[model samples]
Target: MKLAIQTSSGDYALGLIDGTGQLVNAISRAPDTAAAKNIGTLYSALMQKAGKETSALTGVMVDLGPGGLSSTRAGVSFANALSYGANLTLTGVSALEATMLDAKRKTDRPILAMRPSPGGACFWAYYEAGHSVASGCEAPDQLFSRLATEGKAFALAGPLRRIGTEALRATAAEQIDIPAADLACFAKTTPILPITNGTLTYLEPITNMDGAHHIAAKDLAS
Candidate 1:
């Protein structure tokens, strides 16, 4: 009874993954308003499908950003509130990390997960040598420039892929876009571990907007 929520894209996703990693019930919708507005509806629908109450959920997981700020906040807020109300543990996983985790399971090649940033820059991260690495913000040109120096075969995932082939071509980085199903599968194996036991301690808020810039590159330095 692990509940997962992801609102990284325009569409919102809600699902319950059983202990065995099987999808018990899932729903996705492109809401007219912000993702926050549809939280209640999505939660209700999932509960109905599962034939259980929110209180019955064992743990809750949320895809914390590298995506839309408002959407990420909304999803995290909703997940936090629900976890508090239902007495479930909370785990915050990076959306990019999850994307790469999904990609790595599918191929042995290095992975590069990209998402659009607020300022027309890109949120990029790399997974290689069994470590997830965060690369700071980069304009289209900077990203490609760095990729040229790295010269690694990589796969891409997330909403940025939908930015169109022309946009990807503009980067001149050799890569492939992965599907969401792949991400969902990756979540099952290396799922975000709970940081809190459904209590005050479990709510680790990511307050700094510039935190990604400070994400140490040492972990991913290979």
Candidate 2:
């Protein structure tokens, strides 16, 4: 069994995935309190619901997000500590990458996985044929303008905000939601890379930017 956690988007979730990459059970809740405090309760409840102990887990996965800074940090920190204490393998998956993986299963068109960012900017990634082509952070107007100019059909994933509606009109984009269960499913196959450097992925920069610059994951030390 593998444990999966997601706290990005200011929502917290814990999932138990069986060896077959199928979700056995899950628990999700809105950010009613600090993730640091709530995660333990969720973890306990999830394991109880699944009728399994931490020792039963062979690995752990977390969604590295550019969504909510405090929430993401709380989740990642918890995941790192749990994996370390339990001597289990740890793997991190970008929410954007997982969204792309989910979209590819339902559509063949190019995909744009987007999440709202701080300072009116947006975190986005473009994928074609199961591979990432381009990604960046920018305001909605600017991003949609670039997409409109490209004139390519895109299937959009993640939350559907007002900007998402405009993206549909501007680029005729299709909206899709990447469910938490699907994220857990995809996470089972994501590469098993331990986050040994005490660094999270592609989040701090996006959430902390001043809306004047864009940063990529590669720009940061792994």
Candidate 3:
């Protein structure tokens, strides 16, 4: 079984995936009130309710967020510690990618994935036929203008508030609301946070920074 944790969202989630039987158990909690301080508490509770032990986890999956900062760090730091201490494999999944996967289920057409970025612009990615064609951060007007130039229609998906769905309304695009459980089940992977960094400093430095900065997952993964 794999332990999947998603702290990227305002509401966090934990998932247990049993590949042998393709069985999954997903639990969602609002970190604001549920278990924000110590993710270990939440992890322990999930294990207990699922009748499993920490030893049962073959890998720890965490969401590398363009979502919440604190929550993202909480999940990553906790999973990183468990991965190092338990000798478990660590995998990181992107919140945007997971949202796109969730969007793909509802529509056969090309999907537009968006997430809030540091600037006023949003992190946007276009997926066609299950492959990402273009991805980057762009202002809403500029993005809309570009889409207009191409004359392509798309099904929009992501956190509406963060990405500002109002910009998508003119095209009459369909909005997708993917639950945390759905996103948790979507990731079956990670960017590989080096287990060496014994603190949470990396979490601040690594914020869905796009390709502009290098992610040392491969180099640091021992």
Best by lDDT: 2
Order candidates by lDDT, high to low: 2, 3, 1
Candidate 1, 174-218: lDDT as tens digits: 455643433255244344444545536443334332463225533
Worst 10 residues of 2 by lDDT: 213-222
lDDT of 2 by residue, 1-222 (tens): 888888886567889878888888988887786443678888998999988899999987887676777788888778888887888877776777777777778888888887777777777877777666667777867777766766778888876552454544555677786533264545534453553455432222125332322334221112
Off by over 4 Å in 1: 33-36, 161-167, 170-174, 178-183, 186-199, 202-214, 217-222
lDDT of 3 by residue, 1-222 (tens): 888778877687787877652437766677767464667777777888898888988977777666667778878888777887888877777676677877877898788777766667776667777666667666766777667667676787887655554566665667785534264444532254543465432323236435433232111111
Indicate the residue-level lDDT of 28 in model 3: 68
lDDT of each candidate versus the true structure: 0.65, 0.69, 0.66
